[model samples]
Target: AQSVTQPDIHITVSEGASLELRCNYSYGATPYLFWYVQSPGQGLQLLLKYFSGDTLVQGIKGFEAEFKRSQSSFNLRKPSVHWSDAAEYFCAVGAFNQAGTALIFGKGTTLSVSS
Candidate 1:
């Protein structure tokens, strides 16, 4: 079974400050890792993904993540966070199966940005 764990249930960051989110996964094999963000009442957007090749993947909005196979972790980081960045962030891992593809997601970590 594959599972993703995000230990933080909530995080607060001041505007223009840095941010980092932790993620850990368990899978039989190396899985595709991804980070997605969702606003208060909107759909989820892909923050970044690591399929193969470079362990460090760059994403939009100055976000990046490095996949650590040894630790089975992929942590998301941002040099500076904007108020608009306030949202629920989810760490997920995907795998291809006979049925097709499935993504296992963490509960989520809600980000609160303050002035």
Candidate 2:
């Protein structure tokens, strides 16, 4: 079985401060990991993903994540936080094998930006 864990259920950060959202996963084989952000009443948008290649992958919206295979973690980071960055972040994992293509998502972490 595969799963994603977001230790922080909610996070509040002052504007301009750096941000780090934690995520951990458990999978039998190499995993396809992704981070998605969804604003209030909006569709989820992909923040970043790791299939293969460099462990550190840059994503949209000034975000990046590093995939650590040994630790089974893929944590998202942003150098600076903005008001618009407030949203629900989800960490997901996918499989491309015969089992089927479906993403298993974490409960999600809500980010609050303070002025």
Which stretch of 10 consecutive residues in model 2 shows the poorest summed lDDT? 93-102
Query: What digit string (tens of lDDT, one per residue) describes model 1 on residues 1-115?
Result: 8999999999999999999999999998879999999998899999999989999999999999999999999999999999999999999998876566888899999999999
- The per-prediction CA RMSD against the true structure, in angstroms, equals 1.1, 1.1
Q: For residues 1-115, what per-residue lDDT tens digits would candidate 2 score against the true structure? A: 9999999999999999999999999999999999999999999999999999999999999999999999999999999999999999999999879667899999999999999
Model 2: CA > 4 A from native: none
At residue 109, give the lDDT of candidate 1.
Answer: 97
Q: TM-scores across all candidates?
A: 0.95, 0.97
